[model samples]
Target: MLRWFLAVIGYLFFRFPGAIAGFVLGSLLDNMMGGKTRTFKTSFGPSPTVSPADFELHLLSLASLVIKADGSVSQSELDYVRQYFVQAYGKDRANETFRVFNEVIKKREISAQNICNLLRQRTRYESRLQILHFLFSIASADGRVSEPEVNEIRRMAGYLGVYSQDFESIKAMFFKNPDSAYQILEIDRNATDAQVKDAYRTMAKKYHPDKLQHLDEAHRKGGEEKFKKVQEAYDQIKKERGI
Candidate 1:
């Protein structure tokens, strides 16, 4: 679809050679995005689904990547991932998943791009955003989100097709910098009062817990956390501006 569209546009302007050039470029772009030639649909609703096992495995792969980002795996980070799975899934199921993770996943070389490509193809954009939040949670398990961990997550965000502003919004939830509030709202510090209000409403709707109803309870809870962060950011800004 992308290739054909680009080829047509190219043909209109520059004839057969342009169409060929556009086809090549479009094919590259399509392959980079997992070759899904379907309509580009990004909603909080149901998307092309991955099986539970596949989803869990991809998540563990991402967790493994984040753990090793700082050159050493921290026990606290490992424990955090374990606890999250156990809480989200029962101990029995979580243990079985971890068994496979330890024996198969951790032993192999993990590819962030491949895992993210599959995710971007199979999951909703909101679900991918929650995945970033979960990875950040693991990265900050030891208290502070290290520079290496942040960079690793940033790379994953790109491959996952998460926008930069949305990436920064989730990242801000884990840090306490002065601009954290504005970043959380995905807005500029110089924005006017009405713009601030509009951003808050937009973010509130984006992060609302109900948006993840099709996902598991764990993700719905993650959405709630993000929603609360948006609320907090808006309140902080309001208080500062005396609005």
Candidate 2:
């Protein structure tokens, strides 16, 4: 049915090329809606791809779930999300995206776990880490992250198959402390100075924006912020220990 509909649309527009494009897209849509785990492809290539816009939309949808996790959305959280949209997309696109976000929040039936699973299947590990980082930021936007929000995020992380240590590292970014710095670097307090430096370098490499350069600009920026936090943690440890 979708193929036929798009075929008509294709015919109405660019003729045969349009029909080919329509068939490809229609098949992608069918696979998505029919619970088939197939890679998305276009007529031109075999490489699977998810558009940046679609990735952003899923991130926003999961964010909405996190925002509503505690049964209420704080003003600060809403403002933070709005700011994110404005910064990532232009004001005009932000307005449109916010409308979609609002609708996502309104539909309470969608499970956060389901969204995370979909993301895990479609996105890379770095991209999933970036999404988790964004969710943590939203949770911390209200000055404090509530217990419910933490639990919800942890559950989502599990659904995404993120390691517990990675989750802790991302969590440490929003909530700062002496211990959190160690967590961010994924190091132990008793580790030698050289070990700490090694940990920092490893983490810096792991979360570097360059690693996520293939992603859209917004996601790359998110990775950069996490990378900066990792660097800051290392610097703080170095300062305290005179390393």
Q: After superposition, how far is residue 137 of candidate 2 from its true place, in Å?
A: 1.2
lDDT of 2 by residue, 89-193 (tens): 778988877776668667766677777876777766776788888888898989988888888889999998788999999988988676999999887789899
Per residue, candidate 1 scores C-alpha lDDT tens digits across 1-243 of: 778889998999999999999999888876866622333235544456345766787898899989999999999999999988887877998898888877885477888999998888777788788999999999999988899999999999999999999999999999998899999999989999999999999999888888788776777888899999999999999999999
Segments of candidate 1 deviating more than 4 angstroms: 1-49
Q: Against the true structure, what is each candidate's TM-score?
A: 0.80, 0.76
Local error of candidate 2 at residue 3 (angstroms) = 13
Query: Which sections of candidate 2 miss by over 4 Å?
Result: 1-47, 101-108
